[model samples]
Target: MKSSPSARSWIAAGVRHELLTRALPALRHDMAAPVSVIRMALLMLKRQVAAPTVDAAACEERVALIDNQVGELVLAIRSLRDWELATTDDGISRSALVGQCVMLMRSAFDLHGVSLEVDAALDPQEDEHRWPAGAALRYLFLGAMGYLHDGADEAGAIRIEADGANAVRLQAVKRDPGTSPSVLDAHRAPRALAIDAVALQSLADDLGYAVTLDGDSVRLVLATGN
Candidate 1:
């Protein structure tokens, strides 16, 4: 089935943004640090080679440093490659995925003094359908949590509940009355919220999911089949 032009464009933009903002930066930093260290070690070795009398211990230490750096670089590359592979649409456990998302946001919730309650009953082994790839799932969670955290007041609570067989619901209540309207609100489009909302909705759509914002709650519905 062919997708609409706008959908295609949205998917493209979402992928580009994810690559640039998350994956590439992580890869660059992980790879660059070791490369820089290896380069420095090599230059030092070169200098030692030119010296009239090379200190054996110093040369051995330099060689060991270079070896360690190379090992670190290899591990970093492998880890990045594995992460990329995991983002494919191959099925993953729904329960596990949701748990991971919750774990990722736990720290932020603690820092904000907001409590989180998760009532997920979906069985990971029995649920054969995976909502989306790992990275996209993370992106969706990040976007949703970002929206919720911004709206939540100190001591407020966010509840993540699994609604029925195929839907995940995120509800935030007890918000500060004085707090400004949620970014998810159509009328007031704050810059950060606007960008995140668009990205989240677009990515969800591309992944065959539907996101609905009603009051202080957001529900993501997973498609029946791939």
Candidate 2:
């Protein structure tokens, strides 16, 4: 039987399946957005070309719009290609993995009415930090993360910081859902993140790392020593 830590990790692992399921609809939109515009532009261009009275400047404008939309379509296609090619190996670049995962799962986040953003502080220096490929997806979805001590950006994006080479800080600045949530959601609100904290701390302790939980955020670190 798996130990408690392993069991929880197993639970976290299931979230990836749910995330991909929710993300597909949004991914479809990403691929379709540029195509939709390109189609509209083509229709306009076609009308201009077949006009009984065509203006050179108007035709040029339509052609230019179509060109721009086509460029956008190319970028969308390329992003899909990259997403499909992303690796789920044991080790991967933290930044690239985080970015690709964010692109893949950000829409799933939207279902919870939250947006995830990583601090630019986690530049190449930290992005160079190594994390297991599947580990990151688990980490973000797990809800055990760090400080609201001015933790978010002006746009109120949840900040995922690089705590260290093998650590991550999650700071949530959430929005009001404007409804009386069920008891479960009320308990699960950002203000009550200690659930994740406690669970992670138990696992961290077993692994010789440490976790700290405050009212707003929890910082999980892979400490060099206790």
Clashing pairs in 1: none
Per-residue CA lDDT of model 1 for 93-194, tens digit only, reads 567767755665565455455667777464456636665555555555556665566654342678887877677788886845664434324332234433
For model 2, what is the C-alpha lDDT against the true structure? 0.53
* Backbone N/Cα/C clashes per model: 0, 2
Model 2: per-residue Cα lDDT over 62-96, one tens digit each: 77887887887777666443332144555456565
Q: Pick the candidate with the highest TM-score.
A: 1
- lDDT, each prediction: 0.63, 0.53
Regions of candidate 2 where Cα sits further than 4 Å from its true position? 1-15, 84-120, 123-158, 172-226
